[model samples]
Target: MLNLFSRNKQLLDEEIINWIFDSYDWAFKQFDPSVFFEETELVLPTNQYFPGEQNSINGMANLIFEQVKQHAGMTHWPTKLLNVTESEHQPVNPATLSVKGQLRGKQAQASFELGSSVEALSEDTKPTETKPAVTKATSTKTTSIKNNAFDESEYSTDLNLVMSAGHASEPNTGNNSINFSFHPQQLNSPEGLIAHFAQGLAQHLVSAAENPPPGGKEYLPVATELMGIFMGFGVIFANSAVVPRQGGCGGCGGGQSPVRQVVLNQDEATYALALFCCLKGIEKKQVVKHLKKHLRGLFKLALKDCERRLKQESRLSLSFAS
Candidate 1:
C-alpha cells in the first residue's frame, strides 16, 4: 500500500526512449559523429542567429533556409525554393524577365523570342539570328530564370515543365535539385518556419540513408522529427510543439484549447531537447530560459533522466569492453 504513494519518475515510455537513442545513434553514424561532438551549435531564435530585417516573406524564408542549411551541413546540396499557396485560388505566374544559361552537353546557342509568345530557337535551326534581349552568361552549367514579380502558381508549373524538358533532352545528367515549399501562413511564425525547414531537410537526409531507421519505415515521421532535433533545431521544435487555440466563440474567449500541430507532443519534444543538450554537454541554465514556462520543469526532469540514462549506458559499454 505504501507503493501507491511513490512517484513514477520516467518522463517518456521505455519504447520511446529506446527509439530516441537508437535513432540518434543512427544519425551519429550517418552524419559523422565528430561533427556533432565538436561542430554543431544550438540554433537560437535571437537576431544573432537569424539577423537582418523581416521585410519580405520570400526573402526571410530564404535567409532562414540558408542558416538551417549551413547549420545542418547541407550547403553543397542543390536546392530550389517555392512558396506554395492554397490550391483553390487561381495562381498567377511570376513575370520571367529573362532566361539565360547554357544547356548541359549541348554546344548549340539557343535564343528565346519573347513578345506575344515565347519561342526557343537554336543556332543550327534559325536562318536569321536576332540579338538576344537579356543575356547573362555563367561558367557553371545552370538554367537561370529571373523573375521580376514573385508568383508561386505559374512558377511551379513552369519550373516543372522546364525541368521535365531538360531531363528528357539530357537524361544522363542527373537532376539533384531539391524543392522546398512553404505555405503562406508560415511567414508569420518564425519558429514554425524553422521547424518546417528543418524537418524538410531532415526528410532528405533520411531518404539518402543506406538503411532505414531503427523501427523501419513505419517510424519514418518520428525519426525525422528526432533527426531535426539532432540537426541543432531542438529548441525551436520543442517550443513550437504545442500551440494554444481559441474557441469558436470569437472575441468571447469561451473555449480555449491547446493543439498539437507537429508530430511530436510537448513531453516528447522537451525530452528530445533535453537529450540533445545532455549529449552535447550543454548546461540546463543555458536552455531553460528559452523554453516555455511550464516546460521548464519538464525540461529539467528530462535533463536529469537523460544524464542518468547516459551514465548507465556508459557503464554497460565499459563492462562489455572489459
Candidate 2:
C-alpha cells in the first residue's frame, strides 16, 4: 500500500517514522540494559518481512522497523513506573461587606461574601457571622525534569482537570503494553516528546515498584543516555519531515523541479543535534563526539542499502517476467 511516487504517502510515512524514532530513542535511553542481559530470555515477536524477498515492499518496511527496534532498544523497564506528580494549590480569600440602602417606602439592605475560604485541613472552630471565614493551603509537585528538580505548583480548583490537561494524553492502560503516539506537530517539540517519554518512564517505575518483575533493578536518571539517544536519532533521521517548514526558494517564476533533494547539509544536521541536546539538558562538548563515535558504521550500512535498492529498482520493470 506504500507508494513512494505518491507524495502524500511518502510524506506521511516519513513523518510517522520520524516520531517513532524519537519516541523509541527516548524510551530506549531510559531502559536499563541489565534487564535485557539478565538470565531471562526476551522473545520478540517474529514477523519481520525480509527485504531480500522478491518484489516484497512489505519486507523492506518490516526490515526498517526491525532495524529501528534493534537500534533503539537499550534496557528493560520495570513492571512499575516511578511516581512523578504535579500538585496544585488554590488559596481563595474573601472578605464580607455589609451595606444599607433606602427604598421608596421601606429601607432594605443585603450583604454577602463570595469565594469564602473553605478550610478543610484544620480542626478549628468557625467564627461568628461578624467576621469572614479564611482558608489556607500548601501544595507540592514533583517530577523528573531538569534533574528531578522541585518546580512550582500550578494549583487550581479543578485539580482533576488541571492534572489531566497539564500533561499529554495518556495511552490505554487496560492493555499490558507500552503504547503512545504523537501528532505531527508534537514531534516538532522535543521538550514535549522528552516529557512524554519521562511520563512513560514514570509508568515503568510504578509498574516495577508495584509488581517487581524478576531481577528488576533500581531506577536511576540517565540524562547522558538520553542525550546519546537524541544524537543517534537525530543523526539517523535528521531530515525528519515533521519539523516545521520555512520558506523554500526556487526560481521566482519557475514551476516545481521534477526531482529535488531536500536533505540537510552536514553542518546543518550537526547543528540540529546540538540544539536538541541543549534542549534535552545536555550541553557538553563530548556529545557530538559521542554521536560521531557511535555513528562510525552508519554511513557504510546506508551506502550498502542504497546500492542494493538502486540495483533492485533498475532490474524491475513494474512486474516479474512471465
Candidate 3:
C-alpha cells in the first residue's frame, strides 16, 4: 500500500495541487484562499469576539467543503469573485488576522452578510434522471419474472432492497461510533460508482483550476487524497455533512441550510473505500486507525477552541470582579 502511495501519489496530488494554485494565480492575480474563506475581527471593549475564532474555524471549514463539493468536478465553475468584507467593528489591518482555510467539497463563489452572520453561496444543477444499468451475461442466472401480475418473489426482492438500504445498522454503537452503511442506490452498479467520481473529477478540475492554492506541488497529492477521502467517506456512510449522501441533506429545517457534522470516524470508512477504488486494497484495521486519526484532529481542534473560550470567560470574570 505504501508502495502504491509512493508510485502514483505524486501524480494524484500534483494534479490537484497545481490546478488549485494555478487557478487562483490566473484569476485573482493574488494567491489567497482567504478571499473565499475569511473572517473579520471586530474590536471589542475588553477582548471578546462574538461568534469567536472557533466558530470562524467551523464556518470556514464548512464553506471550503461546500465549494469543493459543488465544483470539484465542474467544467465551467468560476474561479474568482469580488471580495467584500462586512463587519461591526473597524480594524486598521484586517489582512493580518488569522482564520482557518480549507478546500474540501466545493467552492463558495458569492457571499452576503445577514445582520450578524456571513453567508457564502454557490449553485449546481445535475441531471435528475438515473443512468440505465448495463446488463451483463452470467453463466448461472436467477429466474427472471415474466410479464408479471403480483409476483410474490419479485415483491420479496424489491422489499429486501428497501429494507437493506434503510434498516442496516453499524455493528458498534456509541456516542462517537459511526453507523456503517452501504447505500443500495450506489451498490446497484459499479458503473454508477465510476461515473460518480468521473463527474467528481470533472468538478474538481474546474474547482481547483478556479480556486488554486499557494502550496504549489505539495498541495495536489493531499488535495486529491482529501477529495478521494471525502468521496470515499460519503460512500461508506449515509450522511449529509460531506455530500448529499442517502438524500438526507435535502430535508427542510427552519428554512435554514442543512447543518451536517461529518463524524470524524467516518473518514476511516472513506479511506478504505478510496483505497479500494483507487488502489484496490482493503484493510479493516487501517480503516479504523485512519478514522480515529481524523476524529482526533477534529477533537483536538474542538478541544483547543473550547479551552480558549473558557480562558476568555475566566479572564472576563476576573476583570468584572476587579
Candidate 4:
C-alpha cells in the first residue's frame, strides 16, 4: 500500500515526464548548454527583474517586450524584424462635412466648385493625430557577438548558427515579419504579458527547428510553452498560468473563475519550473517565495521529485572536471 501510494504520489505521469526530459535534451542540443547550466538566470516576477515605468500603454508594452527578449537570451535579435501593436476594437469616428453652392456664375463657378470638392477630399484624407499605440523599433544593421565558450559542431546542422551577444541569433523565418498583438487588458498584469512575449519568442525558436518536438504537430503548442520555460521564464509562466478573475455582484450569484492564460496548467508549469531549478542547481528558498501561495507546496514536491529523478540519471549533473 505504501509503495502504491508512493508511485501515485508522482506529480507528473510517465509520458509527460519523458516528454519534458526529451524536450530539455533537445534544447541542450539545439542551443548552447551553458544557457541551461550557466547563462540563463531563473527569472522572478519582481521589480528587480523588470524595472521602469512607461506612462503610456505602448511604452509599457515595448519595455516589457525588450526585457522578455533579453531574459530569453535573444538580445541580438534584430528589433526591426518585430512589431508590437495593441489589439483594440473601436468604432470609426467619421468627420462631419458641410457643403454650400451658389447659382451666381457659370464656368468659373463650376471650376471653383471642383477645386473646393478636391480640397475637402484632401482634408478628409489627412491622417488623424491619435495617441501612439504601436511600438516598433527599426534598424538597418544587425549586431552579432562572438562567444569563445560556444561550440559550433554540437548544435543543429540544419541552420547556420551565428553567435550573437553571448547567445544564438534569431531564427530565419522566411519573408514574414514577427508581429505580437497584445490586448490592453494585459497591461494590468505585467507578468501575463511577460509570459505571452516569452511564449511568442519561443514559438519563433521552435519554428526554426528542422523537426518538430517529441510529440510532433499535435503537441506543438505544449512544446512551445515548454520552450518558454526552457528559456528561463518559468517563474513568470507558472505565476501567470491561472489568474483569479474579479468577482461579480453577490446577488447575481456570480463566482470568481480563474482565467487560464497559458497552455500549461498550474501543476505542469510548476513541475517544469522545478525541472529548471533542478538542472540549474537552484535551491527552493531562492524561487519558492516568488510563486503563488497555493503553489508553494506543489513546488516543494516537484523539487523533491526532480532531485530524485536527476539522481537516478546522471546526464543532467554539473560536475566539471579539473
Which residue pairs in candidate 4 have backbone atoms (N, alpha carbon, C) closer than 3 angstroms, thus clashing?
Answer: none
lDDT (Cα, tens digit) per residue for candidate 4, span 5-62: 5465667788888778778877665545655565678887665777655444455556
What do the candidate models score in CA lDDT, each in turn? Answer: 0.56, 0.26, 0.26, 0.55
Candidate 1 worst ten-residue window by lDDT? 154-163
Off by over 4 Å in 4: 1-8, 79-177, 247-261, 314-322
Report model 2's TM-score to 2 decimal places: 0.21
* Model 2 spans with C-alpha error above 4 angstroms: 1-54, 74-231, 241-272, 275-322
| Candidate 3 Cα errors over 4 Å, as ranges | 1-199, 206-208, 227-322
Report the Cα lDDT for candidate 3: 0.26
Which one is best on lDDT? 1
Error of 4 at 159 (Å): 38
TM-score of every model?
0.66, 0.21, 0.21, 0.64
